[model samples]
Target: MVHYDERTPHLHYAFVLVVFDAKKDRYKVSAKQVLTRHDLQTFHDDLDQDLKKVLPFYEKGILNNKTLTFENVAEIKKNNDQFKALKDELANVEENSNDKKAILKITNQELNEVDLAKKQIDSFKQGCLKKHLAKP
Candidate 1:
């Protein structure tokens, strides 16, 4: 889903991990089997290549982040935790601040941070879309 309800819009993709079971003659839900090490390694690169096929203006390597690498699961989780804390703090700022102008400025900055954290988290999550097109 593409979210337009924010300062900077972002996309969210939800999926179920499934793999073919040749012996069983059917597909089975198996995240362990589907999310392989190789898939994690090249997921973003592959996605960028696939996106470029239909999106003329979309640039290759758009998923690459200069400050954060999605490969570090621990780092992503840490940042997510921090993001949550920051959001809670932003809420406090909105409630406590008396100056509307100051509140607006602070809210705008926090919103930008919210957008960045969302992008980072979502980029890490795109690995789940192995061979499926996420429904918008």
Candidate 2:
């Protein structure tokens, strides 16, 4: 998970959203989202509005007896080390890849890094969802 540090004070937790295929007992992360107390008011407002769209389900689940866990509203933070590493890699690529061919290769490497970041975020979101939705 991207954790908070000196650079980002707003990040606080992690979220994980997973979609399971019962027939296969396999799951995939469909989305990764986050919430933070720094924007708690806005977040709650948005959450309330979203819940309104699914009022029936909310009434049946939450209003009856179900409750959402703190896991549902987790925080996000920045990893300075990770950011530095990425920056260093990009700097190295820029320093060495002056030719078009080398630049293209470096660009692909950057793309891979971006994809990895996306997957990491997705995994965190899925984890949060799993915890939030877990039933007693």
Candidate 3:
């Protein structure tokens, strides 16, 4: 839902996080799996990518003030520090995600190689058995 309360039009979106459970072979409402830290972190980026494909004019950014509002300077400083720390954590998470993807690609390649070798071995065994039967 788009709200007019804010300075700019922003989506006040709400939906149940549903994921397909392979074990059950059916879709289930599992917020714990779908609404993950990684999912939340990448939500805006993914949304922006899709939105751009449809709405070319959709600008990517927050629709509100960027300032960290607080009564006291000390409290403002504290909030700023917290925000910085969270940003750092997000960067680290993204970095780790990239590393993991690279690792998975290599692992998949190795598994494919193993599968090919197994198929070749089986074919060779069948050929040898056929040759032996023909000789007899």
Candidate 4:
């Protein structure tokens, strides 16, 4: 997802963006919000123009036939777990901002270690898959 905001012709309000992709059984779906019409056409046009700059490549790369490397798979799992832990931690961090950053830093470091393990496992799977693909 990508976003850019305009400053002129508006000062306080912000144009927003939300995008998501979901895959199921050989079918992929994508959704986008180009404009919300929170203000006049000028503000909305600015958002659309910015989206035009950002959306094409994103749509192509994510929508097209792309192959995931072992690193990519590992990163995905790592990010997922990191986000999950972050979500939980945010609930308890309303009081201690200092400890929150420290804990988050440690959590991210641990996530990297797990990511490395996942990368190794993915590499092993790719090796096995490659062998099978090569067989008659």
User: What value of lDDT does candidate 3 attain over all alpha carbons?
Assistant: 0.82
The best candidate in terms of TM-score: 3
Q: How many residue pairs clash in each candidate?
A: 0, 17, 0, 0
The digit string of per-residue lDDT tens for model 4 on 1-136 reads 2334633122234444544534334433322344433433255356556766878742222212243333456798987898899988986675578788889999999999999999999999999999999999
The model with the greatest lDDT is 3
Q: Candidate 4: misplaced stretches above 4 Å? A: 1-95
* Superposed model 1: Cα runs more than 4 Å off: 1-17, 53-68, 71-73, 99-136
Q: Pairing residues by index, what is the TM-score of model 2?
A: 0.27
Error of 3 at 130 (Å): 0.8
Number of clashes found in candidate 2 = 17
lDDT of 2 by residue, 61-121 (tens): 2122232334332322234456788999998887776676787999999999999999999
Task: Tell me which residue pairs clash in candidate 4.
Answer: none
Displacement of the residue 15 alpha carbon in candidate 1, Å: 5.7
Give model 1's TM-score versus the native structure. 0.43
Q: Where does model 3 exceed 4 Å of error? A: 1-68
**What TM-score, over all chains together, does every model reach?**
0.43, 0.27, 0.51, 0.27
> Which lDDT value does model 4 have at 132?
100
Query: Model 3, 21-45: lDDT tens per residue?
Result: 9999999998898676677666766
Q: Which one wins by lDDT: 2 or 3?
A: 3
